[model samples]
Target: MLESLTMVRHGESAGNAALAEAITAGAEESGPGLRDSDIPLSDLGRAQAGAVGKWLARQWDSVDAVLCSPYVRALETAEIALRAGRAPAVRVDERLRDREQGLLGGLTELGVQRRYPAEAAARELMGRFYYRPPGGEAWTDVALRLRTLLPELEGHVLVFAHDLVIVMVRYILDDLDESTILKIESNQLANASISRWERDHSGLRLLKYNDVGHLQ
Candidate 1:
């Protein structure tokens, strides 16, 4: 059985940079209009991934299995942090992919308000957990898929995924509700952060949350 699982969010990506810039500028939209799955890592992201890889290389004796989202940023992070597949072979899991942003994929709140007003208003009213964009997914959708994925894996599993993926996984393990989970997401963690949890006789117990000491 899987004793423990360590989840790592992909390093900062070009999308991340653009989003940050958009927020800084309070723009109408964000990101480079590229497919969300195609965005690559930024230079800082590469350095962060290298640092995480070295840290993990020293800390973990072995990883029994590795899973990753197929998104380019997540793939790059897994390659770097695992030393280019020198560790456990990475298995791409569609369930581990980032939450589908849909019409909101590359837009900020302002952008959504300007270009997708009804969608934006609906999101605010429906809440983040169940707000499914026209062609995207809800947070609950991501959680349901991961819940299915967990039952089939075992041993020490390492995963390279995304921010929403990380938070949803935590919410699943902790058995949190919409209110509490919303609170959890508000205090966002950094890129490339790691979190660990162990399963025992009782249940899942968190070993770490948003750990990034190696980047220091």
Candidate 2:
């Protein structure tokens, strides 16, 4: 059985910053104009990752394993954190990648409605949890992959990944339903925030959720 699990969302990326700007400007494309997997961190994101590493150094004597998403932003975060904390090397896991947005990859909500009305309508009908974007994986699909990964992890493990992956982890571990998970997702996770669980008699129990105290 796993003793403990600590998950961290990657620090803010250039893509993150771009998306926010795009939303404000009402742009059709909300990403950094690069493939999602290739986007890098912003300056603040690097600082945040460093803070997470410092927090890790203060919290635990050592972590048994470190895993990270293969995406550049996540990889950079993991690298920065590991260097700061003197933690073990991270093993990149493709399974931990950000949710593939597919055809909807860079489109803002307005863009989605304007460009792909049918897809937007379909997504509304299916709901966010089950709505697989044309060529993208749904939230449930994310959970399925995490389910496979969770069982194999043992001891204290740290993961550096995306916000969606963090949410899916909580959904699977807590046995949460669609409504509860969606509610949780509504409060977007902060950049470089921490979520953790520790094993007890009953099994793993949540010790923290979306904790960003370290960043402050």
Candidate 3:
């Protein structure tokens, strides 16, 4: 069983900022759409990653292994964080990549509403967990991937991935029901925030959830 796990969403990416802008604008204007794999980190993202690195440096003894997503944004965050802290090198894991957005790849929520209203309605009716956008993954698919990856982990490990990975890992680790998971995901997680779990005799216990105090 994994002894300890720490997960963090990648630093703010160009894609992340663009999506937020579209959400704020109600997706009226063309959003900054790009393939998930191509997104790069923003300036603030670099600073945020550096901040987390300092925090990680203080806890250097707590981490023995590090894993990261293959996406550009996530990979950059891991590189920057580890480099700043002078910590252990990280391994790339495709399974840690963001849930495929597919047809919903670049569009904001409002874009989904306007361009694919039927699909949007179906998603709301079926609920977010089961709603797989065309050519994309449902939450369950991501959950299965993490479940498989869990057994592969050992010792103190740190993960740098995406928002979905952070949330779904909890869903699997805690044995949460779909309804419960949805409730938690609705709040979402901020970019560069940290979430951690430690194992005890009973089971894994959440030590932190979406913590960004270091950035402050």
Higher-TM-score candidate among 2 and 3?
2
Best by lDDT, which number?
2
Reference-based lDDT, each prediction: 0.88, 0.92, 0.87
Q: Candidate 2 lDDT, tens digit per residue, 8-78?
A: 99999999999899999989888777889999999999999999988888755648889999999999998
Candidate 2 clash pair list: none
Please list all clashing residue pairs in model 1, or write none if there are none.
2-155, 28-111
Question: For residue 17, what is the lDDT in candidate 3?
Answer: 81
How many residue pairs of model 1 clash at the backbone?
2
Model 3 Cα lDDT, one tens digit per residue, 1-216: 589999989999987787777777776433345567878899999889988888888877878889999999999988888884645778999999999977877776777888889999989898889999999999999998988899999988999999999999999888899889888888879999999999998989999998999889
For model 2 the TM-score comes to 0.97
Please list the residue runs of candidate 3 whose C-alpha ends up more than 4 Å from where it truly belongs after superposition. Answer: 28-33
Give the per-residue lDDT of model 1 (tens digit) for 95-208.
998888876778887888889889988988998899999989999999999999988889888999999889988888898998998998898978999999988789779999
Clashes of 2: 0
RMSD of each: 1.4, 1.0, 1.5
